[model samples]
Target chain A: MNQPIAHASLAPATPFRTAADARRAIRSGAWTGHTVGLAPANVQGNLMILPADLAGDFLRFCQANPKPCPLLGVSEPGSRRLPALGLDLDLATDAPGYRVFEHGELTAEVPDLEAIWRDDFVTFVIGCSFSFEEALLAAGVPLRHVAEGRNVAMYTTAIPTTAAGPFHGPLVVSMRPMKAADAIRAIQITGRLPAVHGAPVHIGDPSLIGIADIAAPDFGDPVAILPDEMPVFWACGVTPQAVAMAAKPALCVTHAPGLMLITDLLNRDLAFV
Target chain B: MNQPIAHASLAPATPFRTAADARRAIRSGAWTGHTVGLAPANVQGNLMILPADLAGDFLRFCQANPKPCPLLGVSEPGSRRLPALGLDLDLATDAPGYRVFEHGELTAEVPDLEAIWRDDFVTFVIGCSFSFEEALLAAGVPLRHVAEGRNVAMYTTAIPTTAAGPFHGPLVVSMRPMKAADAIRAIQITGRLPAVHGAPVHIGDPSLIGIADIAAPDFGDPVAILPDEMPVFWACGVTPQAVAMAAKPALCVTHAPGLMLITDLLNRDLAFV
Candidate 1:
């Protein structure tokens, strides 16, 4: 099992009440760690920043693989503001941490994008599982990882993505073990929120999807599958990062794992129903 | 395995285009068989008629156990018309067949209630699984029983219904076997139609629900559960008949198994979502 990757900074003792407050704290260099429990009711998203020349192909890639890369908000070329997602949001400095990539490799981790900000960058905010997880938890669905305070277990699957341009790779999924009844209810609940990874991509036997070991995951920490529970798999937001890395663009940037961009949009609003 | 009870009449040569046409044929004595394929797009319901003295308790029982006995319409004591369910429906004669019960035992099966119709009898129309089954089939969820031309398997479960007065019995469930992905999709499809035995009551293991054998059902015909498929169970309209029999009402009437009351309400209109 992969242990959660530890970051340099520590999370603040008290969580911020609103997305603006949380983003303000992160912007002021007061909190530089993962935004796990911060602004609990707001939408927190994964970030993907690529040069304008490759933005159209990347947009097509996201449109094709919607389950893994549900586009929440997209910024204009060279723009720092995504007004639809957050009124006061600055695409460059709002996220707690950023991972800069060079030739498909992690080059450096920065607190903010001040030094690396480029005029040709286009920002894409993709929907994360946090939104649907909140809905599930609110509906009294027990989440083992949430109770254990660990990151969700994620794995690479034999399922292939509909390739667009150079962005082609195996689909990545996050797994949650649930009793059969809860799993059924989870499908109904998540099926309403197509904006947040939507419903699960696969359920039951992991081997059918080429997952050899339930105890081991390629990303995040693994949680035990209780005797009564079956592992439910959802398309992961990390797919964009993984695909970007494989594509080896000249310069690509993303929010570090668990270090997401908090948006003003209420999680409930994301549910179409 | 329980074989479906053989009725005296055969199904019509062709399905009726509308609920009105189907009910008209039944009322005029032109059709006296099962309504399975008739009025496919409309709602078909279970019938329960009891004395006015027992109607309140039966209504309460249905309200408490809505999943099994979803109330579609009710008639005033001795009134044969249920305008909301059908503009010209005559409750006493519109159904293809009726089962008359005396002291909890089936006394007779009759073509119509003309011989036993009483001034104090109240009619209760309960939603059936056929509506959700139609929705499921429309969504491309292949039902094994339908393909095999066998009745959907049904079992009496350890899961008990909430009692109201003397009305109480274990829940009766209808089973359909499907692959994990189809089962998940079926849950979502059925969850939308609460009026028609919405969603599944239980799934997976039959032993957990006190069902000792999957091959032998207490009601309906058995269909094979493929190795890749798990049995998905939904609350059956048969529960009201089971409860009514257990309660041992002095006099009770119900539609003969498979001979349901076709209603004017389209199955699509039943979806709350």
Candidate 2:
């Protein structure tokens, strides 16, 4: 298991300041760790690559469940470039790492997708919570998990996602415990960035959403919740991975958890206002 | 004491399709009740008329405490018209009723400001919760106060308003009980309308903000809270009134509670997005 990267290590001692710089470093195998705080001003996205046959249904699923799977960009069959997100973005190798799955079962983790690129592949770039986390931190709402060098605690909720074809599963949520004041501000700040899991799905209680234990999360590390803090949950981008796995597509690929596709699009561009 | 006006009576037999028509009715003394639910599509504002000598301090106060006192429009001293809010708006008589205060004590409740209009008077139109409430209702979030035909329960909070000169006091908040789901939605919906107490100041608990009892409120009527409901509070426009009274200006004027100045600006115009 990969140990959680310290928040300080998110900004590596490298000359990669722009998204293009970061992508080049990522493509050249210069950086293989999580891209949490790297390229801090630009938008980082969750990536999912599926065969052309399953792309249409996945698009519909994202449309039906936008809060979890906000589609930032979608590529045509066999395409690797997404000029809208970044002038030089190459989906096949832009992410820090890629997870290859065959029949929904993870087969290998590779630094680049060039080794097993498929002509029928279609890439979907979904908005991630990183953009809003940047917004929250900029607004002075301290994130406990990020501060403590732990992954955001994630849980499978009782709430069901709106199904589209074979893509369906219980909604997955990422949790961050915060003071009520910070939580209120977080809601307002994140609410403006709907492309990145806007606002929160649930707040205050855990069992209310079917979580049996606050200390144990279905995914990620659980951070300490102080007596004054409330556990706020946002619909996770991981939902698509869960749904895609459940669908059992012939071939599917995704960025390894916390390893995202850095884009030239500034976080401000995603803000609705 | 005047009985709470039925939501039906808010719309009279007169044709008030436009804000100008509604103002004309109020000016002609044809409408003399609460303005809630009337001219539903237009923005209704809380009215505050202060002498020129205090206008600067009041404006600073509003600037310092924006959430509780969102200043929508302010008129030149002695000007009865605010062309920005409405082409035909007359600050002197557009509202249904006015409260005259002398040294911060209410001396009279009159239908029009005509009898006491002064050359030194400066009119201020503050954004009211009614605009965001309209947005909330339009978004299908049911307001318990509206449904129960009572005023939104308001309370005084331990949160202090940033002071500008003599204007300083505890922040006033209006509470609406909603399930956690609706509360989250309300935050997103209202967060877009910052001109009118955007988003909520507090959620979940009342005592956390210094309210000793959840059953009793300092202002407005309390409504029922179901087992699933959590009380959400927004910065109330009434904060200005409380602050102004505490300051004890020589003479001040405000629209009677629930009576407001209907403006031509549509509620949609207030949405940040």
- What fraction of correct interface contacts does each candidate retain? 0.46, 0.77
Q: Give the clash count for model 1.
A: 0
* Poorly placed runs, candidate 2 (over 4 Å): A1-15, B1-15
Q: Which candidate is the best by DockQ?
A: 2
- Give the per-residue lDDT of model 1 (tens digit) for B144-220: 77777777788989999999999998998989988878988998899888898888887788887889999998877
lDDT of 1 by residue, A28-108 (tens): 999887787788788888999999988999999999999999999999988999998888999999998988888887889
- Estimate, for each residue in B1-273, the C-alpha lDDT of model 2 and write its tens digit: 111211111232334778888888898999887777678888888888999999999999999988999988999999999999998899999999988888878888899988899999998899988888778888889887877667778888999999988889999898888877888889988887889999899997688889998788887876788887788999998888889888889999988877899998899988852
lDDT of 1: 0.85
Expressed as tens digits, the lDDT of each residue in A114-142 for candidate 2 is: 87898889999999887888788889999
Pairs of residues at least 3 apart in sequence or in different chains that clash in candidate 2 = none
